[model samples]
Target: MNNALEPSAVALGTAGWGGGWGVEPLDDGAWAEAERVASDALAAALEAGITTVDTADIYAHGRSEQTLGRLLAADSGLRERIRLQTKCGIMIGGSPLYGVDSAAAVESTRYHGGADHVRRAVTDSLERLHTDHVDTLIIHRPDPLTRPEETVEAYLELASAGSVGSLGLSNMGVAWVRRFDDALRAATGGEEGIACLQIELGLHHRGLVESAVLVNHPDSADRAVVGEAGGLAELCAERGIALQAWGSLGQGRYTRGTEQAADQDREAAAVVAEIAGRLEVSGEAVVLAWLLKLPWRIQPVVGTVNPDRLRAAAQAPVAADRMDSLDWYRLWTAARGAPLP
Candidate 1:
């Protein structure tokens, strides 16, 4: 990945900013407070050297991007320092997440990857982001109806027009990635393809790692993570694409939100706490460092909007540097809640 699109070891996720997902309805004053929080979080991210920020169009029904845009507009230098990434594909309709009431909101939300949808989505995203182009534009989800060729054509046009720097995929399988890349190569007759793949990965969810370790187990394939069916991590490494881990902090199950953790997860939290004590770092740092120990160089997207937490999580790389293999396995075994089969 070029410097323009290359992400830091840690990325900032904006899902919690500007009235993010699952948030209750907020009045105008409450929303203003949310924006203020978002601004502080962005400043914290920059201070911690987090170069990339991830968001989706459906996030806060565009408030997240609008908030980011306003921040970028206010500080001309901020736009030059940070790389912006946003996703499209899932079309949002009336939903309580956006403070809208509709009985069929779930039915109203659908995925579209047609040429028209891709073009319009990027164009609209650019307008909301207050940028002429995005550092990376990811497909938020797989669109069963649209052909891969249509999506690739749209992506190429956007890249050619200088509207998108790189392409990425999220919540997609290896087969889908191959189809898109194959179409891209056939059209361009070169090696250019996807630049990154984002998926949910953390101690709370070890399906990606389990898929590799449980080779002969009967339930191995069934339990495989959504994007790990065909060795997705190895594939991304071979193709020179970055593997980014969303939900990398495990929703604070092992850290701040232990009160709501299940019994099994509580056990894992204990193990994390042990490691954190030995290392003299916060539990959040240990959790993120565990991901950094992976050979694939997985980029953990820290979703917390709290500046203090973000600064703490940013120390994960340093923690990983000091963590030995035995310590890494100890945390893994606790999360698995059993010895390797």
Candidate 2:
């Protein structure tokens, strides 16, 4: 992996800045306030040695992109000092159903399209980002209807046109990545290939680890290709591709006590709390630190409208020695509420 793509300790997530995942709409004043907060957040991230900020065109209907662009435009120096990553793929319409919404509804509402949409989207994103090019551009998710090669062709064209620096895929199985990787290699005459693969990795989704070795059936094969647990980390180690982690906190479920697996959850939380209490930090910080300890270079995508939460996540201390192998298994088992077969 190139130093430019190596995983930083932290990566700022823009989901919360632009109304936050369909929870609420930001008014003009709120949007302006978000821009200020985002700018300050980016400044702090840069100062903390975190060089990446991840956003998407669909986020707040391009408000996140606009905000990020405005921040960069405000600080001419900071713009060049950071890595920018954004994804496209999932189409959103006013019907409230994403991707699964009807074509008529999609067309009638605000429908974000596929490759063509991506092209226009990137252009708009760049304009809003106030940058000529993006360091990393990711296909947010797989378009089942579109062939992988077709998608790669579009991304390659963007790269060739100097609109993007590197290409990546997200939420795809191994087969899709391999197929896309092959397509990109073939299309670019082997000059440029995929630089990274982004996926949901955390305690809840350990399926990737299991899927890595079970390549056979269609589902298993897909898992095998896409779910290579530490393969991304190991590959990044070899090629310098950074393994960026999304949903690092497991959607806040890790913090709550639940009945389905109350004992396990509580035990794990207690273990994390115990460590955090001793270290004088939040459980979220401890969770993030644990993620950093994995074999792959991890850049956590953290979402927070709260500045204090963001700071705590950015400053989370990694206990290099406190979490032992047994303790790790204990916590994992506690989280799962059952022994690994």
Candidate 3:
């Protein structure tokens, strides 16, 4: 059975590999070119020793998984070189379970976490991914209508069948995860449960850090409304859950020059550039390094399709080790654009 959760310091994200979210869908010719580019990026990532990859069923309307599948199929030894992870539960147009009206389904989106949807989604994801078992299966988002028991039932069944290796959750807060973990433990008799938690974390996106530091401030009340009441990194460490950060490079806002940047991003960019120069690394590495400095061994899912930038991100762990507490706070305070709370 493929039941292991061995993620590295960084995970290569394929969100932009096939391109289907908000952006216009590509034609066959363009898709072929995109896959070619993705192949090159994967090659570079492998060369850099980044063995974990993160993708989702809804990414590029399933094209991302399909592209990954084709690449792995083309190379017999490729599957063994990387730990593959994919997410389900988000239903959008182009999904096999999106009903018969394919064209109409593209105009809408929903979250489904029932037993049947979960099972079918992962099964179909396996088919698209061209793999018997995924190293990790994460629910893309929380389904408000579904019960924890229902998800646990599906997860156990999938794990037993070896269709999914490990379980994870994305875009979910600590309180909800605690409840879900409790039910998952009861279902598995405490043998298995959540192995990772994926959330938006980076220099520009510092809600996870601010969530704790702003506790007594007035912003804390506003944060509670959006489910950022505490530290996810702390919770993940306490529960032995791997904290995988998406948008770990701030989506290039800090590294991609400041000509069009907002005042806040511009300021953050200046600090990041200074730190990068001092460390003798790319700004991309400096941004990712900031997340690596956290107490938890947070794995940043670097999504850059550019091979050079991806390789730069691979250096973040080393740069992080070289960073001091003073510089770390410098970047944080610069990104926040204000004094420490």
Candidate 4:
């Protein structure tokens, strides 16, 4: 916590608070429960010095935004202490059977990558979040058909107009990130650059490392990769960029009660559990501590509506360096069920 990197800025992901994305929907009673859970989680997060949150408009069909809005409205002081980051571009439609709408489905049928649409979506998100300006605004994903310059220009315009404090991009390849970074720099008269790049990085998903090699593209020196982001630790050392790690717990596959917990998962969990017991902590604390041990600045975006779990996660990094290299690799190999070459 006292490192040069401000781990306290670790963000809380609100995707689960809205209860979407293959997760159970929150009924009226569940919504009330979520409010209490979120409130308690937020209280604990604030107390633990975690003051940033990452939410998305499409999460739970805007339910996440609404819930966050309500929470911030209830406590104005909390609003000031925290920095809100939300995404746009992904569209979702209302539904009855699926609880809320599906953003991916909506975009597939009626996708428009225009500035007007971007403005309208951000405005709606701001309304739901009950805030005038978002600390960070990211495009959930780039439209394959849209021009990079056009999208970057739109984001630059928003920043210039003071609608968004900073602009970021998500789910983009290394080429796209560099292209947008250059385009935005030119469009903004070199006044601003990308604040961050959000991507999925964890023990199981090391694709970012392979992708970084492709982004470097020795064959295309003219198109060098810009805006460095990779494995949480590597990226931190290379570019001084913050790593916002999503799915830090492998989407709950590592948990004890989940059906996705296979033998490999159980074995990995056992290793985590043993380490936790030795450290006098929870399994989640051990997983997070491992993440914190990496050289980079990682802010795991954990998505749980449970306050107790949130508190435990906040304390996970307390003994980051206690685990030896062999133990770390043992857990890593068990999690992968394979040895490194």
Candidate 5:
């Protein structure tokens, strides 16, 4: 397939690759089955021309990372063709699971970003991913236990050792990013700060966009997703921090009807469908296209497991580029259930 857009435009997410976190595998057969499913999903992603895969160590309690490792090992040239991005610093089931002598029981997850934890986490992650260096290593979530300087120090150590090519931050605000960037420059004299920021952005989760729209209108408390002061998109644009949006599909609320579907979601779905029909594309394309047309090069992390849907997502750039500014705002306003002020 010909390259339509940049490989980073649509990143394949592997959180569901190793299978949902509900039932533990009973025996070797179950483990094999999970691996098969994970392998197939990744194969589907590749067939769709996605070269960026986003995964986390805590996903399926490390099974997700390990599966990717095995897949890379089997295929000699696949790793070189893709940009593998994985996240660290999220703790699950108490202490570190991988590299332990005993099996790790799947446990609830929470954030942990201590300097020691960060080092150990990246170490374990590299081992599981079967990679010398990941394309991008993200913090996953901010850890309150560690200060900004401590986080940068950990990142510096990893960068020096070639364990991670660069660092990214997930679910962080503009203030935290600026603070960390300043610390990074001061401590190491390195010009680079956070290279990317992964946050919730979609038809439903408009935290960054709403910050700008709802300025001076606090009463629109109903519309706040992350409650930023405003200008995150602008800041990210200025700093060249590529915004990778997770949940870019609104968790499938746009295509699939839900009981909790708000009025705006319904309206947005209608408009999206109309556009899709007019353009002869899938509704999924419409939703993803809307995000693609945003000002910045917002890479949407598509978690779809279906191969056909993955192919449709790859077609977003063509459909998205066709949308004019007027149509773009129509979808945005329909999602907000209010006209732009």
Candidate 6:
């Protein structure tokens, strides 16, 4: 968190910007091309008013951070203008993984966030990112092997040394966040805590919002948010932890007009499309605005290289200006495929 302000609304995602990610992964040649495209996209994104870029060490097996490093190295001035946030903890093998379904295997990376591993991870990330300090350093996943107290001690050490600023989490549960935060506060004596919660949340995945909307229904068969109390969302709201959403535009499922999630997306995208048409904005903007209307302000992590798309995404808050409260629920229900009980 290099003393930079938090990304106000939306952040550009560099997951696909690196090389190997998304529906179809790339090869060596394709990866080179991807780096070129991403560098160009990053320039366009900064010019388009996006100040935050989210990436991870495992992304493209570190090519993501390396590519970003190259860009930053070339333009020393760009370093100050933008905030760099990268994650680690998950490691990737040499194999080039492709497609969305197969991409899940990458998560199986052994989660190791002990003092030694966090120290090594941060050092390696800084080396790859080619920066002295990152605006925010995130733990990609919880390490079952290490206790929260032990992990936060190393994190606090980094923060004190200015090697890292704000701490973060990804794909983590509520209990874990609480444990980590408790440990962090104990270590710092209430001086610092998690800066944000990055999770898979959007029109395509409403687990965070669904828990609140579902109330005490306790029905997991119909919705993914029903199982637990979804204390994370509540905690984030109460604690003022900004909720940053990944895959906010359905990850091309909605905007591409592709039949990625045909049955489910058909109805959801229809409502979003109708709204976008009425508002005269891109479909991506509409979906994003819907997420923004949640109780907490959601910072969207969008992966788009096209300059036009980046600017269109920046218009999310404005596109939402035309939406009424009723229309907001309409979009939610459409995505849920069922009216509120």
Tens digits of per-residue lDDT for model 4, 1-341: 11122335357888877555533456798778767777888888878767778888778767788888888788766667787788877654443212334444553333335676677777888888887777888877877777767777776677777667777777766566666667777887977667676777665554543334545555224323233343333533454446677887666666554245776688777777777778777666677666677666667778766676777777766747577777677777777665543
Off by over 4 Å in 4: 1-9, 19-31, 93-113, 209-240, 257-260
lDDT of 3: 0.83
Give residue 230's error in model 1 in angstroms.
4.2
The per-prediction CA RMSD against the true structure, in angstroms, equals: 3.3, 5.1, 2.4, 6.2, 3.9, 4.4
TM-score of each: 0.91, 0.79, 0.92, 0.80, 0.89, 0.89
lDDT string, candidate 3, 1-341, tens digits: 55344677789999988744544557889778878988999999989988899999888777899899989888887887889999988887445445554456345687878898889889888998888889888988888999878988898899888788888999998777887778888888988768899988888777878877787788767655225427667777888888899999878999987676677799889888888899988888899989988888789999988999989999898889889999999999989888886
Worst 10 residues of 4 by lDDT: 1-10
Tens-digit lDDT track of model 1 for 100-123: 433453447878788987898789
Clashing pairs in 3: none
Question: Alpha carbon lDDT of residue 253, candidate 1?
Answer: 85
Candidate 5's clash total is 0
The local distance difference test score of each candidate is: 0.81, 0.67, 0.83, 0.67, 0.77, 0.78
Please write out the lDDT profile of model 6 over residues 80-153, one tens digit for every residue.
Answer: 88787888777553324212344554545466677876887788788877888888878888888789898888
What TM-score quantifies how close candidate 5 is to the native fold?
0.89
Colliding residue pairs in candidate 4: 91-103, 92-103, 233-296
Instruction: Please give the ranking of all candidate structures by TM-score, highest first, separated by commas.
Output: 3, 1, 6, 5, 4, 2
- lDDT for 239 (candidate 5): 80
Question: For candidate 1, what is the lDDT?
Answer: 0.81
Error of 4 at 306 (Å): 1.1
Indicate whether candidate 3 or candidate 6 has the larger TM-score.
3
Clashing pairs in model 6, backbone N/Cα/C closer than 3 A: 1-135, 1-136
Q: How much is 201 displaced in model 6, in angstroms?
A: 0.2
Pairs clashing in candidate 5? none
Best by lDDT: 3
